[model samples]
Target: MKVQAGELLQKINYPSDLKQLKEEDLKQLSQELRQYIIDIVSVNGGHFGASLGVVELTVALHYVLNTPYDQLVWDVGHQAYGHKILTGRRDVFDTNRLFGGISGFPKRSESEYDTFGVGHSSTSISAALGMAVASHYKGETDRQHVAVIGDGSMTAGLAFEALNHAGIENSNLLVILNDNNMAIDPNVGALKEYLTDISTSKHYNRFRDDIAKVLAKISEIGPDAYKLAQKFEKSIKGTLLKRSNFFEALKFRYFGPIDGHDVEHLARVLKDLRDIPGPKLLHCITVKGKGYSLAEKDQTKWHAPGLFDKITGEIKKTVYEKPQPPKYQDVFGHTIIELAEVNPKIMGITPAMPSGSSLNMMMKAMPNRAFDVGIAEQHAVTFSAGLATQGMLPFCNIYSSFMQRAYDQVIHDVAIQNLNVVFCLDRAGIAGADGATHHGAYDLAYMRCIPNMTVSAPMNEEELRNLMYTAQQDNMGPFVIRYPRGNGVMVDWQRPMKAIPVGKGRKVCDGEDVAILSIGTIGNEVVKALNELNAEGYSPAHYDMRFVKPIDEDLLHEVFGKFKKVITVEDGCIQGGMGSAVLEFMADNNYRAQVVRLGIPDTVVEHGEQPELWAECGYNAKSIAQQVRLIGLTRSMQTIAS
Candidate 1:
């Protein structure tokens, strides 16, 4: 349990245990905690940097506040590792983000101290505000509400809305803006610049504190004099920094621009602010990957670096060095830049995921054309639509799961108006370890239902490139190009870009007994299943149904008519996914064939390795093969019955 020679973290079973330690020992505890996280994540592989950056803040907050009863909500839960460790999950910290183990993010189901389950960014303020308001209504004045959010997350409209509401309500709430100048990648937009100005302005913070001291003395003199001094302070704040006045206008008592690394300072600030009335804001300045030098230098790369040597800071090489395939995002990154070179009208946009979606590549190459619009999803879509209206072709890159936030923009701005905005949805399937909130399971269903929207999912990197290429050719309404996370199965994926016919599919392998149809990168798994089935003397016809919208009726007619036994496999939900499309096709044509549908069932998937999750959903290579073999068993049973 103990990490250091003296063993500080080993004794911390909960927040109370952490509180029992000497104030001086807290600094050592923070160091031990950081090392422990690095040691565990070096082997296990989880989100880095954010957790490391918040170690001091986490230790200080737990030490200052009466946690479980007080209510501490972490925005997105990326920085909750230290919180998890100190609050009785240290022994199980090694199981982070693994199947049937503790999650990488904070979970209400996992622990009582979690307070609220969060995955998406910018929800912490809103959630914590609600908790604060609830405590007020219940007459529980002792219960404190704290929302720890990142500077990048603050760019979202949701965070502002929460802050706005909290301000008007005048409730007891403390919002700690973890200003690390980065999210998953480096922070962007005017808000980031505004915060940076505040961070660097030492004279302003010092002068402001001096004014506060004079105001405190003015309060003792007389009530009227104190009010006059407060009014003067507001006028000076308005004149000095417009951004500082912005928070003050919202009725929040703004504090800090303080060193987040100092445990003693943070604890002191937090204890003083605990009694302060109304909505409070603490702007704690910290470096992303604070303790780790390599990570601090290249914060984006180390955001979620896979397995690595803790001491050497080098990525551990695999024993078996196979030919490395480019990650799906890398393909998008390079392809977007390539396409932008040809088309002057083409513009790239990402909602706070410059690095994650690989839009950073384009951003770096053509700074003017590509943009990281911060954590504003709805704004990003509408902004892209605005660009399309001005005769510019906008490629809006958003994670498939995250696109749910901007659904209205897709319907109203793009599809309804018939704009030529291209939606490049990365992480279009299981999304492996991050769990159900991150799964791209609903894009197929949601996108297909929309009118004038061409919903397409690529089977491989080649198709992805071609599809992206085709979407940018003309003002062909709105097009959605979705591919999965991680590397494509193909190694040599830099194929020439070609225009794929909209809503058309091609046969991959020929068969007779049963037909296997698939969509997305999941089709690669189907190919594996078919090859395995072939080895066992079972041949099934396989079609890569690229577009989910048009359903490829010409191909479906041939598939359903040729084979009585048909199976549809997809990486999304079965309710309204590719399987549903096939069923609809059969109903319209009245094709009375025994069709088997395979995909994610009507249940939430747990966080696990992709293969295990795919198997759990009954769509992995082996699972698909088993489903195909069922055709023979079913046919035999029917023959015997007849």
Candidate 2:
């Protein structure tokens, strides 16, 4: 459908307008919103299934709650597109997740109603709890705090930890468990099963509803009769639902496994619970992809749908002129398969990111050797360590940002023990659109400090393959090979993978007056900068420092002897990252050379295109060359004056 001309949705400039509409119009509004999201996503690829699933919930929440006052915290924030469209962002919906456009997740700076910024999962509950605690401290008891968390997010320990604390504190908060029964793929664990059992238990809701009706009928018998009914209802509920009352045990008043698609029912439930005392959890059962038939059939494919033909619901296929090597993740995934094939001791693991990490291929190839540990990052680390102790070469693949969750494990379990495990840190630097929380900036800082840990980064796919091979063969201690997100430089993979000399940096270009040292994927950009410098009759020596922990002191001394001025470029924090390592190395060795550090500043970088962010942070080719030229010019002028 060609979205109905001048539909009510087109006129919905803001969510306040949504609240003004009659309850009966909500069904039409949901359809329009779904169609709107579908249209936008079909044109500009984005997270589709998630936004589609929560249309009704989004509608209900806006209708029932006094938003921008009654705080709504979306856990992962990927599913908040509907919420965004309704809340004064309908026009900008087409620009979702693009460079310099509206962010895919909830951004506090973008809207007053977006109470907290979120990209990572399981943060909503903690944030909402904090807001509630702040409200209590301020003596503002009138305002309500709500956290809308998905089932996938619920598996995370942080969410549970928040729930445990919230229950004990007895703060007035609402935790809406959006149980879609999927998290990219099917959710795994005891809690997931328990939730499914609760939702499907026909007897539980039927008995509760029957008892409630019976109690209502007895209200004419006076106040004493009402008291008796309350007592009777509690007794029946306790007996009938005798399974693990996890929420109640946490001191939360558990409500239901209600129909999440039913907007009126959801609204009514929220309204009723609006006045209820203490912490409450309303479990709303929803489908991952509700309206779109193709998405409903294969939710994963539509989870983050690409640009597609809207009419056919078919994704637009890109014809490659030349076939390219697989993504870095794919290379890692396949390399692991090959390694596992040779050595049964080699195992694969990911923290609910099989697809993202490309470990799904390994899992398919070697079922027994690979494991998906759900959304538990910390657990994944420790578990990998446990496997390491058994002489298994566990390759723990996790996104760089998520590895923050398991920092302690990286130090205590793997690093301290000198376990022979490989940490394939994917999306290691300047992860473009995901923003600050998702950026893999601090990994080098944190990982470098850990003893017995060898941290290295590859410049391209071939180097990545070689690095993995090197890490696998080296049985000394824990090793990490960090790689960036998206496609690596399309290189000839026909040549067999080779073992790189550990802790070594190589020269990419040679010059006299100035030298530029770069690490990881930024090497390519640095080379481009060098070419530009060459065009201006300024040739700067360039070095790709493959390893971060081992400072490549030999290369540093070589560069220092060759040039009086040096600059380090990295796609990480300048604070304790690659720049700091280089500076510390120069200082420790007593090598006197003027050094300029170029990397992300000690501040949060917002969501945008990777190249745009690089340009903004002075990492792009033009910016780097310009900075180098200016630095060279200053030195030349000073020399002339001297």
TM-score of each: 0.95, 0.94
lDDT of 2 by residue, 84-167 (tens): 988998877777888878888999999997899988888999999999888888887878899999999999999999998999
**lDDT, residue 572, model 2:** 85
Error of 1 at 423 (Å): 0.5
State candidate 2's TM-score: 0.94
User: What's model 1's overall lDDT?
Assistant: 0.88
The regions of model 2 sitting more than 4 angstroms off are 1-6, 208-242, 634-642
Off by over 4 Å in 1: 1-6, 208-229, 232-244, 319-322, 637-642
- Model 1: weakest 10-residue lDDT segment is 210-219
